[model samples]
Target: MSARFVQQLPHRRERVADWFARPGAVTRLTPGAAPLTPRAAAADLAAGETVFAMPVGLSWRARHDPAAFIPGRRFADEVVNAPWRALTGWRHVHELADSRGPGGAGTVVVDRIRARVPAAALHGLFAFRHTTLAGDLAAADRLAGVLGIGAGVGREPGERLPRLTIAVTGASGTVGTALVALLGTAGHEVIRLVRGAAAGPGERRWDPEAPAADLLEGVDALVHLAGAPIAGRFTEAHLAAVRDSRVGPTRRLAEAVAAAGTPVVVSASAVGYYGADRGGEILDEDAAAGPRTEALAGIVADWEDAWAPARAAGARVALLRTGLVLAGGGGLLPPLAGLTRACLGGRLGSGRQWFPWIALDDLVDLYHRAALDPALAGPVNAVAPGGVDNAAFTRTLAEVLRRPVGPPVPAAGPALLLGRRGAAELALADQPAVPARLVSMGHVFRHPGLAGALRHELLRPAPERG
Candidate 1:
């Protein structure tokens, strides 16, 4: 099967310069090179690197192009190690077409991955599977920076910022509201999704349980963060709510977007989807779900699967498997803070289970990246790249709060004290994860490491993680 994509610039001077000039300050704006031949060097946009285009997920890599043709007018790469064997190969081609507008219009270019594989099987299996194709996508994505394209252009007097629009589901939730407030402040047009009639100026409406799907029009990007909270025990009712909260609304949103047409979809998922990574090794996106945790992990797998309609309709999708988000008001900060302050907190269980944690601010930034980055899609491990042992986590927190880290709590302590709710989570375990996909997309983490991350955001305003 084939895929076609097109992008444009207002004038010609943006893309072609001597057919290839490596995008110098003067060369990036040579002022006549319409239909610019995008530059790809030995390390820039070359063979054997991953790229995160919309159709392909965040981990999509580039295969060596036997047809690069030295100084050609395009850059292309294919998926060499796709997860599926049914698909022979997936080629990503970026071409610049001539523009009839002013300033010698040039397009950033359109990237298309045409595959020789069978569509039915690959679609049924992994629609946008591109991760294992290469080891590093960042080195390749950084190619754009070298070309002096987009942000590389710097500011030539009246430089136009890339148009950024943020679409949020559950705009009324505590976290959702925070996202809307931040996105709006960043000067982005924030579009909110509502259940009833579309009410506000920056809002749209759709109900997942409705008999008919609704319209998902004009949204360049989306963030599916709408889901009911499972605060109480995992009762049958709660389990159904948990599963449906994500899958139901997701299906409705996906179908609506299918009809109305949009570009990218970045949705939320949970680390619980990993279902207790008892295996010692870290679980990257490619890790298979273990049998013990299949039921829980299947929820995530199914949640992600529901987006197939949108994917088939040609919308890029990203599934974010977020860990324990450490925000001030939401998820876990309050209890952790209070327990430690009262000098009651200690390592839970064997203190060996891995705790994957992410700073709240970093979590927000992750959402922004998923919404804005044209390259990211598919499964992205949203936790900070580092995973600490439970003891290590407690020690780190104690050190940060200037407290002692002793008096180990037994495995049954949680069960005896707080009941099964606390015991179930503590008894189970997981391993580390790398935000490999995000880093590959050129995201510089404000909180890449832990101690510093805790010191700043938890203490003073964390310095810009730019």
Candidate 2:
């Protein structure tokens, strides 16, 4: 079977080509639901062989046809070896051309594939690819504008922003992985700070408890995402792990940044700083910390304060008071999505506690901005604007998945699993947080509504034609 998909991308042909040529482009384009996992880096996309790990211990190796590669115009790849190579064939060609017309000022992307898979079965994949491409390009454009690079300058469209060398902790985490890929595709150098010895190129050893003095040396910016996860039964050990990980390590990293005189530092924080059970109150970055009695609230407050060293040294620091992050690959969404799909999803407890949330991509973008945009400083609530209550969230998620709502989960359900205090502070917590700082800075959210955000992450059918 043969299939062709075309998309009018609002980016110059050269820009689109540059994105494809970048190291993390393939990763960004691949959907979370896709079975194939990219085993090759961006440098291996041309001429070099690329391998993909498939389910059931299968693998597919393909080679880019260097002879047919036309820079900034076209490229093609074909399966050189695979488990089904004898039973089926696979080849794909990517073509780019400048759009023509009175107001046309973009590129037309054409994807042609020859494979045994039916076009209908492949629609979701291509749709996801195009959506991701458009979003990435748009984000790059916005970043360029914010940084005052590209356009109006002599730089080519492909060079939207000056390349940056950013060092990131928690590089293997969900948010970190997405942020690193986004940065890599934007033509930035990413140095992952690993706990152990440096693994490969672009990785460096970092001791969170006592970071090396030169850890931030030569690094343009530092994104500190390392912290023990807060989700659990809220046992004494769990609480200690969460607090100890952030306060001490963050202070240590802040000192290192100050020592190295790193100009930019973006650290992870949480909206829980506002305390739990603040019903109906719209909290922004300016809101005071919730009473110290709240476990998470106290931990988050210390977490944000740990950056004092860096701030004192005059480095621009951003504390992201993040909310519930929604993504299909991991985090809060996957398990919730599974429950919703199984018709076991419903409102929790009173169903009236406010739930502040943000799309994973939006959170990544906020981090990217905080790292690059010097104007963004201090606490920034990283969440979608309109906050929803537990009941609303449950209904919206159910609607998105086209599943009926199951019976409401009684308050005791979470209390039994998380203990009374844990349930009250976590599963039953409420903080109607908003991104006032981001909004004031004219930040654009790709998915502002819960339905749309859920749809995008879950790879649901889109209204736009593919």
Off by over 4 Å in 1: 1-160, 196-199, 211-214, 292-295, 416-422, 425-427, 460-466
- What are the models' TM-scores? 0.62, 0.94
Please state the error at residue 178 of candidate 1 in Å. Answer: 3.0
> What do the candidate models score in CA lDDT, each in turn?
0.58, 0.85
- Per-model tally of clashing residue pairs: 18, 0
What TM-score does prediction 2 earn?
Answer: 0.94
Give the least accurate 10-residue stretch of model 2, judged by summed lDDT: 151-160
Best by lDDT: 2
- Candidate 2 lDDT tens digits, 60-177: 8777988878888888888878455665688889999998655446789999999887788788788778878888888877877788776745344336577789999998888888
